[model samples]
Target: MAQLTSIHRFPVKSCRGESVGSAVVEPWGLAGDRRWMVVDDAGAGITAREVNRLVLVHPEITDGGLRITAPDLPALEVPTPDPARQVPVAIWSSTLTAAAAGAEADAWISKALGVAARLVHLDDPTRRPTSPAFSEPGDLVSFADGYPVLLTTEESLAALNDVVLASADTGRDPLPMTRFRPNVVVSGVEPWAEDDWRRIRIGDAVFRAVKGCARCVLTTIDPDSAVREKEPIRSLAKIRRWDGATWFGINLVPDTYDVTIRVGDEFEVLEAVAPGSGPLRPAP
Candidate 1:
């Protein structure tokens, strides 16, 4: 039996994630995760990739709503209202019509990052629908990377750590799982066993394994400080490249949109499908 050891939600894209005891699972993903994003004045999305400073911005839920703090500006609070203003935006390849969350959020971000920007909330009803491959009649999502939860087994990280340690120069410390930023980390499993999980029941919530998550530079970004390192990325590239991209974690489809997940939730692994049958590894 597999057990859940941690739960995390990134309130904003590419920023620091909050370690939570429990979280509500919506169709798109965890209720408060990645619902709002900072975008330029022309409605173009911004992320830690382009603005490394975004890594310094941290968001926390407050009694009023969401409070955000960055190194360069005072904290700004925005109420969790279905904002009156709406706009069209793009997240990855999907085009979405979302709500412009708060002008105050924009002001704070603009001042801190020294760029003209706005906060856009993902509110498209059509986009809320889940992928046809995993959707039943009523599947709904809030906002996630592409699924409900991302699962990565500790064994996989251990396996990768071995590669990281072997490849690193003498002084660097071994990488932590935070580098991958999975929502769920399962223990007592074989290396990469999560790749074959058909269904996993954590407490009352059941998550279906949908696909393999393709990794990116975000995996190399240090979550705590937003600093980038080269050893692990180079190591992972040598060992785990898939389809020309290095990848980790398994994308998930929850049994229901209303399920809530918490840390210490016991997981019952129902079945293991074929392992090592997904995307190709990147050439080193």
Candidate 2:
């Protein structure tokens, strides 16, 4: 039986995430996950992809809002922005009105990143919908790249690491699961078994495997050191490359909003599409 072994939530996009024993599955994703984000002067979403140091920023969800802390900077507690303070923000291709966290929060983030940046909050995740190509109608997501939940398997990580060690010597260390930043990690599954899963049930919640999470330069950024290196991305390209992208974990969209998932919860595959089918495609 496959059991969920880890639960993680990034209260702020591209920032360090928190591990929890349990998480509430809302319509968009885990509660408080990616509810806030760092944006450039133009109000476009920023991530570790460009500024690796962003991963060093840690956000703790507080009573009213968030308390963000980073090296060489004092912790800053920010209250939820008033809805009337909404600003137009763009995350990828989706543009939506997000509540601005105000100048105090923006200044703190700007100093921490050593770049002009602003902090914005997603007052309602439902304002942005998932790509219709991979999702059902009316499917919504938080400030995530696309899907709601990302799931990875321990066996797959081990297999990828073995490949990395066997491949060209880059002097890079074996990668940790954190490199993938998954919302849920499943143990006791065959390596890459999730590639074939179309529908799965965890506890009382059901989810549709929407798409394969394509690898990117962000995967090369070390979470702790804020340093970039040729890595898992290099190795993944050798084996998992398809359709011009390297694939790793799978993206999931839940069937409903009101489910609570725990680390020890058992998961069952209710349906599976054919192998070699695009990991993100709906089962025919």
Candidate 3:
């Protein structure tokens, strides 16, 4: 058994996340998780992976909507756009409908990052379905990359940091879990134990592990400093490279809704099976 050490909620995709003691589980994801997103003038999604300063944009959840704040910038309150007024937006290759937060928001965020960007809200959480390859029919998600929740274990991160510290090629500094931007962080588990989780229960919520999280260059960006560096990825390529990608953590879909998961909640694996591992190892 492992303990859920933290619950993070990212109101806006790829921006800074806030750690909460407890979060309400919605069918799409935790309440308010990634329901908002920044997009280019073409209505294509923009993330910190491309604009590092986006990590500095802090969206504080408000009664009516969001209060977006950033360093050396005046905060802006963005109200929820009318659900009836949705516009076409592109996420990856998918064209989805979302509510535009109006010109004020677009200008604020654009000026904040010194780029032309617009902010949009997921008017309906059920608008997007999870990838059919990994999810059952009727499963849905918000503006998140794919799955509803991303889970990472402290033990696995510790193991990766150990290898990173031993390497002379990397910065030799241990990375924080924030770099990965996981929604649920678990502790007190063996390194990479999540690899075998088929189904698990955390607190009152049950989840099915659908896919392993393939890391990208976004993990190399520091959320606090907005500085990009070669790290975890540098070490991950040595120990976690497989299928032509560096892997870490896992993606989960909830089996139930309205389940509140709190920090310090006890989690247990109900089912397990060895996952595919062609070249993955502790270290090369």
Predicted structure with the largest lDDT when compared to the true one: 2
Q: Which residue window of length 10 is worst by lDDT in model 1?
A: 275-284
Name the 10 consecutive residues with the lowest summed lDDT in model 2: 165-174
Candidate 3: 10-residue stretch with minimal lDDT = 275-284
lDDT of 2 by residue, 111-208 (tens): 99999999999998889999889998989999999999999999999999999988856565689999999998989888988999989888778899
Candidate 2: the clashing residue pairs are: 211-280
Measured by TM-score, how close is model 3 to the native structure?
A: 0.95
lDDT order, best first, reads: 2, 3, 1
**lDDT per prediction?**
0.73, 0.91, 0.89
Q: Is candidate 1 or candidate 3 better by lDDT?
A: 3
Candidate 3 has an lDDT of: 0.89
Candidate 2: regions farther than 4 A off: 168-172
